[model samples]
Target: MGCCVSTSSRSTCSTRSHGGAVSPSCFEVGFCGQKRTKRTFSDHVIALQHLPSVPNRIFTNGKSRTSCIFTQQGRKGINQDAMIVWEDFMSEDVTFCGVFDGHGPHGHLVARKVRDALPLKLLSSMHSYQSRQNGSGRTCFRGNSKKSDGGDSEKDGSAEDRLNSIWKEAFMKSYKAMDKELRSHPNLDCFCSGSTAVTIVKQGSNLFMGYIGDSRAIMGSKDSNDSMVAIQLTVDLKPDLPREAERIKRCKGRVFALQDEPEVPRVWLPFDDAPGLAMARAFGDFCLKEYGVISIPEFSHRILTERDQFIVLASDGVWDVLSNEEVVEIVSSAPTRSSAAGILVDSAAREWKLKYPTSKMDDCAVVCLFLDGKMDSESDYEEQGFSSATLQSNHSGNAVESDDGQKSEPSLQRNFTVRSSEESDSYGRLPPEFEGNADTVAAEDQNWLGLEGVTRVNSLVQLPRFSEERPNP
Candidate 1:
């Protein structure tokens, strides 16, 4: 038996499955406007009757039978981190998980939007590919053959190779579609704002991962000595990487770090020092797309083993301060499976204060999916009367301390708009000194400081119009 609540009408409907019955038995909990029909096992509940397109399982900031998710706002203006765990995603044996980190003025919205839509796009692409394969009378996991020296050809490679190829193509198509959608969204301005996504799909014993930006995914596996070890699963796509920097610079995008913070390199416009994006690839930030910034995700595949204990997906906030080993240790030491994500987030918050007292804490989000099932057993610490409520209250997005160190009620929703003055003559226009001096500006090291929400200066610089006749680098 289960209950469904309708938010629009503030009503509840109880459903029970009868033995050997083919349908649900529904009972209305309250008096509704419609007359109650005779109760029958075959009749569907009015409250439960809804669109077939609705997602059946979507978990955020909560715990499921095999996973836990949590996010905490930082000292920044708003939390720009989002996460999800969708079980039974494409089939009974498949699951999807992702973590997104948004940056710039409207980052929170972009992150949330991607979290809710990217999976659906990927699913659609996968189905389309399968349909085409079926129509062609070929298996989806088979690729074209390559001619050999003897003029004889064979299948491209092994089954695993073909599977990887299929998923990589799906990821690329979905990512491209997602970015295109963001660019044309009427209500969203993605010229100077964007989000990072690190997603993974688990099908049976295999894992397919795709990601952009600094957010990361890792697995915790048990060693021969029964010690838990952390294995990083994705590369952090920062602008400082050699390949990334070379591409950006070749396309006329400037890549450099401010003198004060040489460790963090950023991508800027060719002629203007603005919108210092820290990542090499991301969704949105169209102004930089022509200059080598892409939404293409790096893809990888791994087969799960008996020793694999769990997987952790987190924003850079957690990775900034917590090492992979530290994160694995923290999650392993958690009092209970349901408390793992909250505890990991809380630990990151404390680390931020200790490591960067002067800098604002970045938003943190985490998703923990346990594999072995044995980890869900109650720990001895929980037996000592551990209070799960206290842990959740402290880390969950609820009444908490604001950036100013004051107690305040958390706003359920925040509204932001680009000011009319900001959109006037000053908007998307280069300053006098920057005009026709692209060479000089590109030669000099830019001193743009800090990422959005990291330092006093805002990294979300206004866009600048590009000259059509500008020479290539």
Candidate 2:
């Protein structure tokens, strides 16, 4: 059963909620139409729900079964936490792509915030892109699954450079905007809430990447024989990497496990907890702010290819289980983009489910894109022989179905909007968050200063963000 827990300080939208701390008049809770609480102002800190937090468990051979809490009510959980195969995302302009992974709770809500935020950010960024393009007369361009490197044929003009400038604006602006939107929502406090984001912006022949988290981006191309090859263009925010591990220890953050692991091998969450979240680097997680969360910027504009066969975008749900090569194989063999996403999620989710029956099934979110084989060829859309052109998808259900054909437990998920020709939304709403949680604060704030070797790219320009036109704020 799914339950939603929210403490609305004000009553406006009517959605079910529970286990929240709200004032007698402004707050209310209802389960299946039964009013559990009524007329109360919400407390500053409250659990959207009182769901159990068991150890992250996954059954062997099960796919990505990350634990998730769904309010199962109305829009209350619409964005609360969920995952979908995103079977179809047909587009005419630069393929729209994104990856949003939430933490500290089910990813559905964070994902929703991201889904809403990205389009807004992109729309907001259009003004910036347009201004830059108008001023310089540069060519325009643009995911996770979107290739980082297009063929040399695609990498022609100032498109890559302009793309970088625009996206930088989008991410920084959206981060702040998201904070504001969440705060103003009916029931939500400044709880360390947020999600990791990685997206792509493509135009004409150019491709750009925008990211702020550990989620990765890759490019793949197939040979005439129909075999796919992939290349990774993103690096992880590993806290225990040789260089990073030492920095955490120096800053007084726990670099190793608390279970008496060896010093050199020991590691803890960049903020708190153990088991899974050890990333010294990631986005969102208001709790990690004190540790210089805002200081960490995204890595952008690695590369894109026309020879690029396909692109893959996924939450850690996919990475948590499949190897890079394994992921490539699944996507390469899949009949369609939607099938690719479903196959990947279904496989990953089951692994987690079987391994962690006592734990929450990791919700899997995948957005995959395949090249228009006919685009490279002089064939018309009709000649491309797209069996499902008018249809939004060409997915194969069994790609993710069980042996018995029974569907897995319903996880949280939501629809997303794609922004094109530059989305020009406004900016600056969220205050850079503070207040690290007890379990993770010490590590997150660990100030391992004066690290050698690794150079911090504070103001580096990459695709999707940054441009010479706008003055740095």
Candidate 3:
């Protein structure tokens, strides 16, 4: 007999197997079997509550028949990283890929929200821009480009250049609209939470990219001597960058490194030292928007060549422990095209444990897009092993001593804590949540800042007060 369960709002039931498990026939295999059938009443309710209004064509799992994508949760808490790969995105030959790394209390939700909504926004903007061009009967880029002197000069550039211009405009519009929507979201509290995005669109031989934050993208190509070489495609938008730091300081936001972790620079408010965000650009984080933190993505274009093999988009988790050369070598040596991303992620996880035995691992996400439609033979490079020299110079900055006098680097998984006015006396004491065995804490409440198991110092040196508003005695 079928079992029935009822709640205050509704009722549900289904045939159960002899072992009390959900019937296998009722399950629908999602892309790469990434999604499983709901087995309980609460699971079904949660799925129904979060269903998207519009269907998505993007694949989030590495097991997809069409593309490669994978993500692993860290020891700290729920995975705050997300990724997507969409084939035939806007046209028969175009493709879209992105990776996001989230931070703060609601970071995981923010990352997934951007993964589902950002691509749709880009598609809509592209359609609207095309409509405007069709009506005006002009080939200019929204009146931003200089007018040609005469003749066919306006259409003289190569096809690649024209494609880049159109995509650049679409990316700008979509990113701005996405950030605006996040700010007004009724269910999300984005005052201190945010995410970083590294996205790319490949139309035929041209590749256009728009990104914000520390997540990165890189390309692997064969050199004249048949050796695979790594080419970094995006610059990490950290607060330490000269231009990024200047803008924040101009808006009265303070930028500096803590005495304990001197290698990592962070951005803080003028009156309070809370929310020491490491990245200079990100979605949400409404608190810092007024202090020069912007969502405008840095854009770039690359024309693919016969030598280019594949492109990898990943969050800082992967980049933190692995260098560009090491990542490229690992992907190139994968046993099969479908297993490339998974192998790389597993390798990173192993490295985290080996390098920082005492620190909690960070969430890792990766997307591997092959260009030649086939996997190359394994190279003759030595077995997977990390050199001490490479670890000291990973992308963000050089290595520094931790509070316990151990070597460490700035991790993208750093924590963001906001203290209330009444909690000033408990500044140096560890929160009760982290008092016992660290691994025993709930995933949602795990702290990313104290990964090395060290006590945190209060970031705020002095509190601000208003003198003129005092009551007359």
Candidate 4:
């Protein structure tokens, strides 16, 4: 059974009917029955009771076996987390889900803009690539299956190559476009503001993930022993990565950890010590663009089997306090599909308070997509040691270490607005003067500082093209 939840008791004035089932639009329903369009935390839950008509010109594409839930908690000021789930994102075979975590002064706006625009832009890029292929007298198939005139092995390799190339180009261009928009936006200043993006596009059993910055994507699958395991699908592109640090140094940028937090390495300008960005890749933060920071995303793809259960994408706030194993366990063991994201974020928020009492809790956002509605099978879940009672009993979960080195496990009380103005360090901002100096230095060394080398290296290595020849005009 597919289920969707509405967290608020209020009903909506306008409801949409899909496949004989009436679905409520949270936007039309105001909190407590009033009329408003602004989405508050109450309207956050969206559950499709039944899978809509599949392979049709309707929303949710052909993803009849998919269900998703998201939850967010604000900190430091405004909620810096923004996300979207587009059921019929592009075609009848695609579903797009993304989560963005904003940092710096204008991060909230940047995150929101990216959340609203990135998917459409990405879809457009993919469509353009396909159109170009069509013009070249080549056909491209959607999802995992493809039509080819080659042998089985050749077909498999060719299909993978085509899909990878399309996605790589799409991701690279979409990020560059998004960054360009951010820079040109009249109301927003992105010099020191930026957001991390972790996105997934599901077409049938095939999954394509594009990620930048520290946010991550994790897959929960059953092991041979029938135990749940978490598989990290995307790398955390932070300054600590050897290649990332090397690239920064090669581009004349500095990479080092703060005196207080020696374990967390950050990217800095060659001329100044301000705006210590933690992630080597991100959207906006133009202040560090010339200093080796980039918006290029890392892309990966996976074909799901029966063993795959679900995928979780979240910002660093969740990953900082929770391990991959713990996150998967909590998500797989959630009592309800809609509550999965909430429960995880709730647990993270509680951990943040207990772990870093003096520090302001970082904003937390999460997207959980259960595959094949498999979580609905109670007997199989129970046999796998994922009983509801076990989940409730182990509510305490695991103990986590705080930033200040304290360790604790607290009750999973949900708090969506856990902000404090007194928090000492809030994504330490770089003075305008520092940004000015960095820009000047980067401009002077643009030719010899290896910026072109870093850019070329950051680009994904191209895969063999399926259509090698273009039709003569």
Residue-wise C-alpha lDDT for candidate 3, range 26-75, written one tens digit per residue: 11001111244433232222121232211223334433323467778776
The alpha-carbon lDDT assigned to residue 113 of candidate 1 equals 73
For candidate 4, what is the total of clashing residue pairs? 3
Model 1 regions lying over 4 Å from their true place: 1-56, 138-157, 373-473
Tens-digit lDDT string for candidate 4 (1-473) = 11222223333322221112122222111222345565542244333222121121112101112454444544445566676555544433356778888777667667877875676567557656654664687544434533345577687677667776777788889888888888888887787777889998776556778888877778888889999877767766767566677778888888886665444567776666656776788898787788788888877667677787888888777876676777888988877664677678889888766666655566677877776643344453354345565332222211121123322121111111111223212212222222444422221211111011111111111111325453452
> Clash pairs of candidate 4?
4-47, 60-87, 60-88
Stretch of 10 with least lDDT, candidate 3: 23-32
TM-score of each: 0.69, 0.51, 0.67, 0.65
lDDT for predicted candidate 3 compared with the true structure: 0.61
lDDT per residue as tens, model 2, 287-401: 4444433324343553334456566666554554454556778767655443455567667666554543443333455655554322122122223243332211212211221
Predicted candidate 1 versus true structure: per-residue lDDT over 75-119, tens digit per residue: 766777788876555443456789988876677778877876787
Better of 1 and 3 by lDDT: 1
Instruction: Give the lDDT of residue 247 in candidate 2.
Output: 58
Candidate 2: how many backbone clashes? 93
The number of the candidate with the highest lDDT is 1
Candidate order (lDDT): 1, 3, 4, 2
TM-score of 1: 0.69
